[model samples]
Target: MNTTTLLFEAPGPRGRRRCRLFEIISWAVLAGIAYLVIQTLDKRGAFDAAAWQPLGQLGVWRQLGVGLLNNVRAAVVGMLLSMFFGCFLGWGLLSGHKIVRYPCRAFTDLFNGIPVLLLLFFTSLALPAWGLPLTDFWFLVIALSLYSTAVIADLVRAGVQALPRGESEAAAALGFSGLQSMWLILLPQALRMMSPALVSQMVIVFKGTTLAFVLGGYFDLLRAATVLGAYYSRSLLQAQGIAAVAFMLINIALSQTAAAIDRRERRRYGVPPIGTGSRSPGMPE
Candidate 1:
């Protein structure tokens, strides 16, 4: 093949062109809808001086900061707890003994089957009656941790399974104990393989924190928005717009951060960057 043909075939220029067109079209459609909505609201006096006065007077920055603080607290705590529990459960599942592995798998599957919001409500209500200090924030964290840990465990397990059998055999031949083999030879590689999946789980937990409103706490962005809407029923449209913007910002930030982390991990592992001059397994250089 000629150089141009070779390069184009390697990266599939046609496919890339199609993808770019699709993204452009999607953004155009979204912008058109947004413009129409804004126009509609303006025509209905929803964006008038009096209607938007509450949002302006409420200090948008202050409300945003408070909402962000609450979200960060719940997301960070839940992510930490989820990683801790997930690592332990993942290790247990690979313990080679049915007694330990079966129970770990069963518990992970059990929690994975339930919805996170329902789990939060149940734990918040039940634990308080049982004398646990289950605040709304803590309840949300627990629910997020439980649900995310189950997913992380499965990802870790898949990572472990992806390793070459020769690595484990070599560790055993070198006189390493089972635990030592896992620590020294298995987990490090497995974690690297699972980094992308774990980041996705973290994003899910972060988004799930919005469900904290169910427990009547003021520490959630959605709850704060709901409170604002109730107090300013006449300007519900503006209040909802603010909430939607906040959520969209949060989701965008998270997605970008996760993508950065994934790129860093891929580079650290010597994997080629996506959409660049990289070779896949079984492909010629």
Candidate 2:
């Protein structure tokens, strides 16, 4: 209650009544939407037993598992590369040298404005035309990595900026160089504070693998679902439903794992789980 009141005063009786009315209206609206959707799906025979039966087959799951593996493989590799380049570019964006900062700034502005779909298309077509024999997997990974690299670079910059200015003063008093203070002190706290946002980006990375369907010959989950639908004849919806569920489950697992690591790191390093201007892990307070 105290924390809630910090943002604004606690709701009075009339305000609480109004909130209750709003909740009731919102639920009623959602219920109406659910009923309409169910009716539409029923009219389309989406609930037919045959349409959903392939979901129970072992072979169907095996195929999905294979495609899901490709999605995970690309997403995992893309995220790693994004983080590496994101950090490097992020650091470069803050560099004292115009040579480094200007190029990094230009890179971020240029790539960040372009859509990921365009990047994927460009990579798929341009690389092969340029006589690079890279596989479609590399094409997809590279595209996703390029866009996320800019986003994460921005996150890094914002994270550091959100830190209190006094941290820099303290680092200076301890005779640390600007680079030393940033790399050792500011970046760590900034990353900790940005952990939740990073996890969200990881989710985006995984979902972006669906764009691989456009590249053809890729075994991402969407393609695998298409193959399954062809095999099962009338079960495309079922296969797609399973794929959606799989994506959701994996995303949930990723978020939870990230949260666990953030918690463990904070506890191990004797820092607040989240807050402002804290020292890096293992640094003397």
Candidate 3:
């Protein structure tokens, strides 16, 4: 190894030993904190197995099942709608006419910049005043879709923009209209390139469904947990841990699936390897 110092020298034996010691210390501290938290929770009766008994009851499971179904329904609908509208808006963003491009750009920026929770709140409260008469489910789905549409729009736009100029030039030479070129050539390629980003965004939309609990009318996973907790004395802590674990497991599974798809796409496309920090255009890691 080159020991020549540029910013700092590579670790010598003593430094490496110190690094290992620091790692051990960090893990020890983390374990201690975790132990303390568990002890505290136990003292508060959070570990009482009876508190979790409600989860095994048929009625309780039925309610939670319904909530899960509702959550999945909203997420699926929102993801589909977002992708549809986002594709069109993305096309508009790349349009030659300022009339199409500017409006799309402005709308995308406005919605994308707003917090999803605020959008849900605004959609839940304001639409009734505007005489839309949407139910809580529709309101939440619309809000989630709108925010996701903006994000996916930007992702699409960036993907298209990143394509090789030769593709467009060849399409023009072949006498393809701009729309034809985009639909038949560019859009397909962009979709493949941005698949990982789109999948990740879908996960975000799925997680956002939990926000529906705040609206009171939507009985999502979080609300179901709240109901379960209420049925048992001082079981809120138990319910919270259960719900957190459930969400964590679901998210982990989704991320793993996405990673698998990403690997498959990379292999199919024969794309060269990239560093960890590199990601799809206009998408955050």
Best by lDDT: 2
* TM-score of every model versus the real structure: 0.78, 0.79, 0.88
**Candidate 1 colliding pairs:** none
Give the clash count for each candidate. Answer: 0, 0, 0
Candidate 1's TM-score reads 0.78
| Model 3 C-alpha lDDT per residue in residues 74-186, reported as the tens digit of each score | 99999999999999999999999999999999999999999999999899889999999899999999999999999988888988887889999999999999999998999
Q: Looking at candidate 1, what is the lDDT of residue 222?
A: 71
After superposition, the stretches of candidate 2 with alpha carbons farther than 4 Å from their true spots are 1-11, 158-195, 262-285
Local distance difference test, per candidate?
0.77, 0.86, 0.84
Error of 2 at 132 (Å): 2.2
The list of candidate 3 runs beyond 4 A from truth reads 1-15, 272-285
lDDT of 1 at 67: 78
**RMSD per model, one decimal:** 5.2, 5.0, 4.5
RMSD of 2: 5.0
